[model samples]
Target: MKKKRPSLQDVANQVGVTKMTISRYLRDTSQVSTALRSKIAIALDKLGYIPNRAPEILSNATSKAIGVLLPSLTNQVFAEVLRGIESVTDSHGYQTMLAHYGYSSEREEFRLASLLSYNIDGLILSERLHTERTLKMIEVAGIPVVEIMDSSSPCIDLAVGFNNHDAAYQITKEILKSGHSKPVYLGARHDERTIIRLQGYEQAMREFGLEPRNICTDRPSSYSLGCELLKEALRRYPDTDSIFCTNDDIAIGAAFECQRQKLRIPNDMAIAGFHGHDIGQSMEPKLTSVLTPREEIGKVAAQRLLARLRGETVTPKILDLGFTLLYGDSI
Candidate 1:
């Protein structure tokens, strides 16, 4: 037979305390004397007792937990966002439950349903668009939710992000102003953000009386993909004077390929990337890119959620932290 799981009563019995005392101690350490607290702590460790939170959640009590959903786990951008969120959640004694949905609205709906079952106090979502069922679940749960990374979309409750379209448009205008008229947009993943960035690029190109050119792929963004896209761009649009990549991963990769082909930066071709990563700055001809306030967005999103949870009024349902253009040698 399988060994039985330890219970609160087992812990109480081992610590020579009533179950109510154990429950009080679990709820708040201040309720128990220091000596008893130490005994209970040791008993909990020894018996491997896990306090079931289902009872507390079923009673409509706060779970003291926040659910965070990300589209990608390997992306460093989300990693930085997670770091910023944890910095705030950790100090406030709240736990974070993370789920990855791989940029699928359907997968996001599934992951969110699982998280809601835990009765989390609030939610932090990476994407603005959600499935209808996901929206219904959030409405019924009636919990605070903050969507990050794009402010242009209609949010369920609150949003924290910079304007993606404007950021791309501004950068594209800068490229044109610098005399790179025939710039091509290199996009990957074809995600919502990527498509928005492409649209921004197209808008700028059209405004300048130049046709927009795009060399895109459905594959996830990577350094190798960047190299391949650059080769294909040169082959297809041989007269292309500049390359504007969706993100630094592709930009840096294209830069390396340029070097391999004996092309001079900005002379033979100008390149710009989005999401100012440290690696971009470290490149020989530092990459000119749009610097997103990713960490700040995460920190502010967590702050807003926590504020709402505390019954504090959070003004401006949509918060645009904004973006900056990093003027480096690559552009």
Candidate 2:
């Protein structure tokens, strides 16, 4: 279990005063004796009681805690983004509460409802489940909601995501530039992000007057799936020279399959991935990938929510966190 955070009651007991006086001091209420204020302030420092400064709009509730609802924490993409979100939130003395719904819409709704029961000031929704009911609930909740990871929809007050089409097109173009006429698209079927990446690959290939047969999306990538898919894709397109996985995990699997078959990384078959997972950098032949601005996106989303909570009427509905190409040994 975690250590208990000292509360105002603790400070009240230690300062030898009623909770009313402590509340007055926290709110900077006048009509308190100077000597008593000093004693209470000292006790506050000694007991380490942090005053929760939430937006005043709630009127009945206040909190410095924000809730994050994502698909899963096992994925390193979420971990890196959380790192960025925490970097800013910790400095501002706010705490983050994480909840994994594993792509279930019902679970997401439940999580959102549960967070409302607490005194949370804001929420970061990484997935885009823009149902009318969800929107209605958010409207009644009287809090800020920021969308992350996907940029296709602006159903919320704020959003943060990169141009999926551009990122994929650039990576695919790199594959073609390296003398690979037919490159394979390796990944799962995502929502709009996946569709954009698919379009990007098709668009790049079509620009070169090539057919759009150079693509294959799959279930979440694993060594087994990578090995199995690589065998079939290579057999079908024997002249294929490169493979671009949607995320780093899939790319890593493809790289491993090439190793098992004694294929040189870029020399034999170029490989790349998205999400820029940390494991890619440490692989035997480092995997080339695109580094999404996970941290910046999280930080920006938080800032937008804060702005909304402060009653700002700014239209920051769309935020583009650009991508960075990581040219590792594989490329």
Candidate 3:
């Protein structure tokens, strides 16, 4: 037989106090004397007693926890966002429950259902699109929700992000202005954001009286994928003068490929990437790219969710933090 877990009564017995006193102390220490509070704390620690929060959640209907959903855990972008969100949640005595959905709507729905079952007070989602069932679940939960990373789409409740389309458009326009007329749009993952960036590139190319050339894949974005996309771009568009990548991973990959082929940066091929990753900045010919406010978006999203939870009205509902263009020597 397994040893039994310590309970409230066990702690009360160890502290020589009534079980009700122990329960009251656990709930609120203000009602209990300081001496007794110290004693109870000691006893609880000694017994290794763990309080079950299920009952408390059922009683109060608030778990003091926030649920955050991301498409990828290994992505450094999401990691920065998580750091920003936790900075706010940790200080406010709120716990964060994280879930990864692998960029799949069905998986997101499944993960969201599991999170909702825990009675989380609020939710922060990285993706704007959701399954119908997922939408229904959120409606029923009636909790504050924040959709992040893209302000172009309509949100369910609240949103905090920059415009992906405009950022891509601006970057592409810059590349064109620099006299790289035969620029190729290189993309991987084929996700919503990737597609939006493509649209921006196409718009810029059209405005310049040039046709958009693209080499894309549904494969997840990676440095290796970038190399592959670069090879394909060069094969199809031999005259490709510049490469505007969907993200830094691809941009860096393409840059490395150019170096391997003994191609000179900006002379043989000009390369640009989105998201000003540290590695991209550290490259020999630093990558020219769009620097999105990822961490700030996360911090602001958490703040808005918390404000809503605190019964404070969040104005405008949609927040556009904007982006910056990093003019590295690559482009």
Candidate 4:
């Protein structure tokens, strides 16, 4: 009922070469003469032969593939990070497999299991907070792991990210120095990073002897949610002079809401956000944000994994890439 796939021997016979010669040619073209190489290539094309990699995989135990786990695809920040990863992986002749878990540790565990079943060489994870089962599974896999985006939690193997708490603290202090004491924190998702950023904001407010207000949501960060949070913040704390959002999405949303309310930037209400997302700068009153090195984190994480795979030593398991605060029209 189905057509059989052509084998290596079939192509070898058609090319008038021994099976071993065909095998050597397939592995390395440089091993064969130019005329023989051309003949083998022609035979492969004529017979529609596909080289079976199962035997090589059985001997090497490597799929020549790396697994990357992401939280949400909607977040535009990962685009740059993925680009950096591909820049390294492609050059090294390794492929990447991506999986998303919507920021859930349980879903992440399942995805990790699936990736492991394929015998991936290494893994790149976005979150540091993993379930106990996930941790055990990663330990058993015995593959190189690199965690990115949050450096607050203890890492499994290697960590490449910035200190989210310190970044938030520095930005919040800057807002305070700009003469906006009545500051409120706006956040969403309430993930690990969200909590850390909140802690930084709270610490800054407490150090300055200013009472902090937090208006947050359990939903994922979005422009719409930002507007709702800002609306609620204004209603509860009518004198809310400054608002620090968890990410750029919420900050942009808050900026739009401020415009609808006819509020002047920094004078009536100052808005600042985390992550130097492009839309932040495109705004009429450009958003002030904490710029995390997202792309460098991805690039460095891939490099470390590749080094481990190549049997090279990777020093300093933990890496803090650092962050920058970009001041703009919106304080």
Candidate with top lDDT is 1
Q: Per-residue alpha-carbon lDDT of model 2 for 104-190, expressed as tens digits?
A: 677788777787767688889877765566667788977788888866655567778888888888988888887877788765645
Error (Å) of candidate 4 at residue 317 is 1.1
lDDT for predicted candidate 4 compared with the true structure:
0.90
Where does candidate 2 have its weakest 10-residue lDDT segment? 212-221
lDDT of 3 by residue, 43-85 (tens): 9889998888999788866898999999999899999999999
* Cα lDDT tens digits for candidate 1, 1-331: 9778998889989989899999999989999999999999999999888778888889989998999999999988999999889899999988899999988899999999999999999999998777889999999999999999998988899999999999999999999999998999999987889999999999999999999999999898899899999999999999998999999999999998998999999889999999999999998899999999989988999999999999999989999999999999986
Full-model lDDT, candidate 2: 0.77
- Which has the better TM-score: candidate 1, or candidate 2? 1
Give the clashing pairs for model 1.
none
lDDT of each: 0.93, 0.77, 0.92, 0.90
| Cα lDDT over the full model 1 | 0.93
| Residue 307 miss distance in model 4 (angstroms) | 0.7
Backbone clashes in candidate 2 total 0
For residues 1-331, what per-residue lDDT tens digits would candidate 4 score against the true structure?
8789998889888988899999999878999999999999888999988777677667766888999999988887787788889899999888899999998889999999998877789999998889999999899989999999877679999988899999999999999999999999999987889999999999999999988899988899899999999999999999899899999999999988999999999899999999988889888788999998888888999999999999999988888888999999887
Each candidate: RMSD: 1.8, 4.0, 1.7, 2.5
Worst 10-residue lDDT window, candidate 1:
48-57
lDDT for 81 (candidate 2)? 77
Using all chains and alpha carbons, the TM-scores for the candidates as numbered come to 0.94, 0.81, 0.95, 0.91
